[model samples]
Target: MALMITDECINCDVCEPECPNDAISQGAEIYVIDPNKCTECVGHYDTPQCVEVCPVDCIPKDPDHAETQDQLRAKYEKLVAAKG
Candidate 1:
């Protein structure tokens, strides 16, 4: 599943840099995660980097954007390909 930033987020700006997919961004108040870009670090890392670095643990599974491992891998591949 893609990860999401909850309202509990402290806006510490710590999670943004940790996201390998560049899915996290500063919103009007709290940081937001772009589900389309989020892969929960499937292809880049063993775990979600944002969640690992989040001080408040506000990053959690996005139930609304649930995806399988294969799906996440495909997304990751597409993202890296686009970047290159």
Candidate 2:
């Protein structure tokens, strides 16, 4: 499943650089995760890096964009291919 940055985010700016997929970005207020680009580090690491580094623990799975591990891996592969 894709992860989301909640309103509880303190905008510490730690999560953005930690995202391997480049899915996190500054929004009007807090950071936002682009579900289309989010693979939760499926291809890069065992755990989502952004969640690991976030100080507030505000990042959580986005139920609205629920996806299986296979789907996330597929998305990660697609993203990698697109970068080439």
Q: Candidate 2: how large is its RMSD?
A: 0.5
Model 1 lDDT per residue over 13-40, tens place: 8888888888988998889999999999
Relative to the unseen true structure, what is the C-alpha lDDT of residue 59 in candidate 1, on a scale of 0 to 100? 83
Write down the worst ten-residue block by lDDT for model 1: 51-60
How high a TM-score does candidate 1 get?
Answer: 0.96
Q: Which portions of model 2 miss their true places by more than 4 Å?
A: none
TM-score of 2: 0.98
Q: Rate residue 78 of model 2 by lDDT.
A: 98
Candidate 1 residue pairs in clash (backbone atoms < 3 Å): none
Error of 1 at 58 (Å): 0.9
Candidate models: Cα lDDT each: 0.91, 0.94
At residue 72, give the lDDT of candidate 1: 98
